[model samples]
Each structure stands twice: as C-alpha cells, then as structure tokens.
Target: MTQKVLVTSIFLHAGGEVDHLLRAEGFEPTYAPALTKRTEDELIGLLDGVSGAIIANEPFTDRVLAAAPDLKVISRTGVGFDSIDVAAATQRGVVVCNTPNVNRYAVAEWTLAMMLGCARHAVKNWTEMNAGGFKRFEGTELYGKTLGLAGLGGIGKEVARRAHAFGMTLLAVEEYQDQAFAAQYGVTYVDLETALEQSDFLSLHLPLNAQTRHLINAERLARMKPSACLINTARGGVVDTVALAQALREGTIAAAALDVFEEEPLPADSHLHALENLLMSPHVGGVTTEARQMSGVRAAENLILALKGQAPASPVNPEVIPTARYAVSAT
Candidate 1:
C-alpha cells in the first residue's frame, strides 16, 4: 500500500516538483484545500489515514494529534513551528521537522524594505498620491542609523548583512552565541533595555513562544526613542497589536511596518486600520516566488526522508526519531 502524505501548505505543489519527488518515493500525496486554514475538526478529518504531512501555520493541537493515530511525520514549510504542539507530538513519537534558511533572503529583503518604508513614509505617501493630493512628508534615510535586532537567527543574520551595506550600526539582543558572526558584522550585543533606548530602528525576528508572546507592549514601546521606527517581519504574537495601535496613535514611535499580525487577515474593526503612521502587509515577507519554490521542495524532501525511516535534515524533535511511531529512525 502506498503511504499517504497530506499537504496543507498553499505554496507547495504548484510550481515545485513536489509531486514528482513524492511519487518517486512511492508515497501518494494528497493536498488539502487552499490557504484557508482548517479547524481542529477539519484537520483531523483530513489526517484520517495520513502517515506524513506538510503543513503551513495550521493548528495541530494535542487533540488533533491524538485523533490521528497513523500520523508519523510532519514537515513544516517554514522555520517556525509554534502553531504545532511539538511536545505532544514528541510524546506520541511523531517526528516534527521544519525547513530553515530556505527563505532567509526573501524575508531579509522584505525586512529591509519595511524599514525603508517606515523611514520614507511609503504607506502614507502612496495613499496620498492615489487620493489626488500632493503631500510630501519629510523622510529619513537608513544611513548611519542604529538598528537593533531582537533575534539573530538566519533571517536576522541576513538582515544584518544587508543593513551593513547601508552603513547601519547593529545592536542585537539575542541568545544565539555566534561570536564570529558578531565580530564579522560589528554587531554589538546588548540587553533589551539598552537596545530599545538607543536604536533608531528596532526590528523583530524572534519566534512566538511563552517568553516571546507580546514581548513588545506598552512599556517597551514607550522605551523607544520618539524618532525611532519599529519593524516586525517575524511572528505576530511577539507584539501586542492593541498596544501598538495606541502607540502609533499617540506617536510613541515615529512609525512602524508590520508584515505579520496577532490576528491573520486583520479584522475590519481593528484599531490598526486607522493609524497613519503604520504600514502593513499580509504576511508576504517570506512568500516570494523563489522562496515558495525552495521551501516547498525542502519541506517535501523532509517529509520523504522521515517517511523512509531516516533522519530529516531539520528535525525539530530529533529525540523522537528512535521511536517515532515506526515512520523514522536515527541513521
């Protein structure tokens, strides 16, 4: 019997040779509906007999995992797996893996674009220009500015590399102890308080976890320089959207550009909608065509390797491989 693999990521199987890869492995690939995420019940229904899955930011809670006894492996298209319950998956001997560094350049470019947008008032300028009004707001340049990075992972490193070319001084608040990277990029590691107080632009690149949930709130927003800008191309849950709205309304910071939100497809009544100093994108920072092709193929490869009882390249819970529901083994 050909094993079944469920694919929920919208970016996959469209342009990439994902189907060819899966079929070559003798695995039958089944795609879920479009990008609209499925509820827990819907997910369980889709995963009925699936032995492997390639998922997006869909909810795969413990209940859903328990309901799907045959599920052996989950390959996430992106680096962040906060949406999945890794602990529960590990406990049940289900291997979880993610494609890291696949879309690093795309996200890094988007982050740099957001920073430039905030500095040059891209949103307001475009809005005004389309309205048949001529209003040229004074803009600032990125040159010789201080950029504080909240996390220095793959994406952050790319951002730092790009920022260095533009003559930006880098300050990072990171747990990644890569002294070589720091020395090469001239990144000054600092505490959160110092980074916030001194940075001209504070960019976020952290995962959404217990300690990182709403890491930026009213108090921290108030700590930034009045002329500073905030950029978040990372997880939405890292910043408090309500507090961010109020901060923009009251000019707590000069401006902000956000690609992710606490709520996807931001509600119509969201206070963020009324802010003039805010720029927003619909979480497209890592969804470029090139990125989609690379990440999709990488995710498919992860699933295929795990299903073959071999170690995946980017296993989130490698400890489970020895006993991963008979789908994968440490090799």
Candidate 2:
C-alpha cells in the first residue's frame, strides 16, 4: 500500500510542488479541508491511516499520537513545536522535525510592521477613520527609540539589523549571547526586566518554554513606559493574556500589536476583541509567499527523508530514529 501523508500546513500548497513531489515517490497526500487548526479529536480522525504528517501548529497531544498507530514522522512548518508533545512522540518512536530559519526574514519584517503600526497608532487611526471619526494623532519616530528584544536568536538578529538601519538603539535578553553579532550591531545585552523598563518598543522573538512562558505579566507590564508599545510576533503565551487585556483596557501601555494569541482564533467573547488599542493578526507573522514556500519544501523534505527510513534534515528527537517505526540508524 502507498504510504499516506496528511498535509495540515496551509502554508504548503495542497496540489503544488510538494504534493507532486510526494506523488512522484508513490506516496499519497491528503490536505485538511480548512485553514483552521485541528483539535486532537479532529487530528485523530485525520490520521487514521496516515504514516506521516506535514503540519502547522496543530495540537498533536499524546492522546492524538496514540490514536494514530501508523504515524511514523511529523514535519512541521516554521520552528515552533510547543503544540506537539515531543516526549510522547519520542516514546512512541516517531520522528519530529521542524523547518527553521526559513521564516526568519518573514517574521522580522512582520515585527517591524507591528512596531511601526503601534508607534504611529496606524491601526487605531485607520479603524477610527473607517468608522467616520476624524482625528489626527501624533506618531513617534523609531529613530533614537530603544528597541528591547526578549530573545536574540535568528529572528531577533534580523530585527536588530533592520532596526539599526533606522538608527534605533538595540537591547536584548538571551541565555547565550553572540558577542560578535552584538558588537557588530551595537546590541546591549540585558536581562528581561531591564528590557521591559527601558524599551520604547518591546518586541518578543523568544520561544515559549518552561522558563519563558508568561515571562511578561502584570508586574512587567507595569514596568513599561506609559508611551511604550509592545510587539509580539513570537509566541503569545509569553505575555499573560488576561493581564494584557486588562492593561490594554486601562491604557497601561500606549498600544500593542500581536500576531499570535494564547488561544487560536481568539474566541468571539475574548476581552481583546473590543480593544481599539490592540492590533491582532491570525498568527501570520512568519508568513509570506516566499517564506511559506521555503518552509513547505523543507517540511516536505523532512517528511520524505524520514518516511524513506533515512535521517531528516532537522530532527528534534534524533534518538527516536533508531527505533522509530521505519527503524533506521541516524546518518
């Protein structure tokens, strides 16, 4: 029987190059009908006979993985894997791979857009004017403004490079600092607390993990300057969603722009929905036509390699490969 791979990454074309690539190898491809994320139950239903999965940030919990006996590999677009239960996948001998650096520039560009939008009150002004209310608002220039990055990784470095061109001051918080890059870009290394207090635009580029989850909460939000803006193109759980809603509602910060959310689709009754001070997007920060294609191809290659009983490009849990369903030694 031809092995089946489920494509839940909307970024990957349902019938594009990767689809053709899979077909050429005699592998069958199936796509999720909608662009929305799939629940665990939905994923279990989708993975009935699937041997591999090309996914976005779908909830692939232990229960879902346990239900799919045939699944051998999972290739996710973009770098985040917080939604997947890696320990469970590893225990089940499933290879998990991620496409990284593919969306770095896309995310960096989106960060700048969000920063500028918040700085200039562009979203609020546009919303007001569209509703027939006329008001000219004073906007701040990025030049000479302090930009504190929560994490100085690939995306953060790109953001530093771009912000430097605008003559903005750069500060960053990272566990492992790149000394040469910091000196080249003139980035000041600081702790998260310092970044929060000093930044005119506090942008997040960190991952969501144990130490970093809810890294920004009520107390931290209070530390920000009243004229400051917060930009999050990274994970949403970094900032306390409830605290953020209260802050935005009370003008705790000048404005904020978020491309990701604690909850996907940000329910209709969410407190964030009515805030004119908040600008929200459907988690499309690391997304552009170019980036999407790069990520899609990388995800496809990882899936294809793992399915062929070979080592993938970037496996998160390489230890599983030896005993993984396909049973191959790591290259």
Candidate 3:
C-alpha cells in the first residue's frame, strides 16, 4: 500500500517540486489549498489517514495534532519550528526536520542591505525626492562604522564578511565561546553590553527560544548609542516588537530595520508602520529565488533520507526518531 502525505502552508514555487519528490518516494502527496486559518481545517480534512506532512508556517497546535493521529513525520520549511508544538509532536512520536544554512547567504545579504538602508535613510530620501521636494538628507557612511552581531553563527559570519569588506569594525557575541571562528573572521568577541553600546549598527541573527525571546527589550535598547541603527533579520520574538516600536518612536535610536515581527503579517495599526525612520519588510530576508529553491530542495532531500531510515542531515528533533518507525517503502 502506498503511504499518504499532506503538505500545508502553500509555497508557490516549491509546491510543484515537493509534490513530485514525495511521489518519487512512493508516497501520494495531497497539497492543502492556499494558506489561511481555514487551511488548518482543510489539512485536517485531507489528513484523515495521512502518514506525513511537509509543513510551513501554519499553526500545528495540539488540537491539530490530535486530529491527525496517524501523522508520523513533519518536515518544516525553515529552521524555526516554533509554529508547531514540538512537545506535542514528540509525544505523538512525530519526527520534525528543518533546513538550516541553506538561507545563510541570502539572509546575510539582506541584513547588510537593511543596515545600509538605515544608515543612508534610503527610503525616506527616496520618498521625499519623489514628492518633488529637494530634501537635504545627510546620510551616514559605513566605511568606518562599528557593526555588532548578536549571534556569530553561519548567517552572522556572512554578515561579518560583507561588513568587513565594506571597512567596518566587527564585534560579535555568542552564548558559547569560539575564539578561533572570531579570529578567522576578524571579529572581536565582546560581551553583549559592550557590543550593544559601541556598535553604530547592531544586527541580530539568533533563534527565538526561551533565552532569546525578547532578548532586545527596553533595557537592551537603552544600551545602544543614540545615533546607532538596529537591524533584526532573525526570528521576530527575538526582539520585543513593542519595545522596538517605542524605541523608534521616541528616537532612542536613529533608525531600525526589521525583517520579521513577533506576529506574522504585522497588523496595519502597528506603530512601526507609521514611523518615518523605521524600515520594515514582510519577513522576506530569505525569500530570494535562490534561497527559496535551495531550502525547498534541501528539505526534500532530508525528507527522502529520513523516510529511507537514513539519518537526516538537518533533524530539528532527532530524539523523536527513537519512538517513531521509518516509512517502510522508502527502503
């Protein structure tokens, strides 16, 4: 008998490849219709006897999991698996996987672009210029600025490389020590306080876990130089959106560029929308054609390997495999 699979949170480009790949693995994959709160209901409807799911940013709460009792695996589209209740999935013996480092270059480039945007007040000047007013917008130069990176991982290293090439001083802080990596990148390892205080442009590239949720609160925001600009390309909750809005409104910092928000599809009433000095993107730092296809293909490869009872290259919750049985046909 052929196993059944469901794919949810429709990604336009990757949908075709995901369907084809699952079919090649001898599983019949039924894609849930376009993303919506009601899409959850659609997934439940299609998941009646489904064995696996290739999930995106849709909410996979305990209720959703309970509705699909036979679900054996969930392959997440990105590195962050916070959308799914991992504990509930573990209890149900569901294996969840994510593709990391696939979007490192794309996200890092976007982060640097945001930093440059903030420094030059690019959007503001462009808006003013188009309005037919010769606005004298004096922009800050990046050639001699200090760049602070919150987490010195793959994305952070790429940011450091680009920033260095632009003649900026790099300071990085990580939870665990890695002096060798810092030395190779010419990154000065510093404490969070010093990095936040000294940086002309502070960038964040960390996950949103318990320790990192709202890592940039009012207090941390207060530590930054008044002329400094803040950039966050990582998970949204990693920085407090409210505090960031307040900081931008009160001119606590010169400017800010946010790619992600604590809430997806940030509300129209959000204050950040009205702020002139704030630059916002709809969480598209890693949405380039190359990154999207790479992430999709990498995730597909991982799913195929996991189904074949082979170790996945990027298993987010490897422990779940202990309780779950690998798909039989994959072998």
**lDDT by residue (tens digit), candidate 2, 1-331:** 7788899876566569899888877788998843675678988999999989998888889999999988999999889999999999999989999998899999999999988887787876887899999987778899999999988999999999999999999999999999999999999999988998999999998888888799889999999988888989889898898898888888788888999888887788987888888888888887699998888889989998998888999999999887666843222
Per-candidate total of colliding backbone pairs: 0, 0, 0
lDDT of 3 by residue, 180-289 (tens): 87787678989999999999999998988899999999999999999999999998999888888899889899899999998777878877788888899988898888
Q: By summed lDDT, which 10 consecutive residues of candidate 1 come out lowest?
A: 322-331
Q: Which 10-residue span in candidate 3 carries the lowest summed lDDT?
A: 6-15
- Candidate 1's C-alpha runs over 4 A off are 14-16, 328-331
lDDT of 1 by residue, 1-331 (tens): 7788898888666334997888877788898844664689999999988899999888889999999998999999898999899999999888999999998999999999999888887877888999999999778999999999999999999999999999999999998668999999999999999999999999999999999999999999999999998999999999998898888889899888899998786778888877878889999999888898888888988888888878989999999987655753322
TM-score of 2: 0.94
Which one wins on lDDT? 1
CA lDDT of every candidate:
0.89, 0.88, 0.82
Candidate 3 segments whose C-alpha is farther than 4 A from its true place: 12-15, 33-43
The estimated TM-scores of all candidates read 0.96, 0.94, 0.93
Candidate 3 displacement at residue 75 in angstroms: 0.8
For candidate 3, what is the total of clashing residue pairs?
0
Look at candidate 1 and tell me the lDDT of residue 252.
Answer: 90
In terms of TM-score, which candidate is stronger, 2 or 3?
Answer: 2
lDDT of 2 at 163: 100
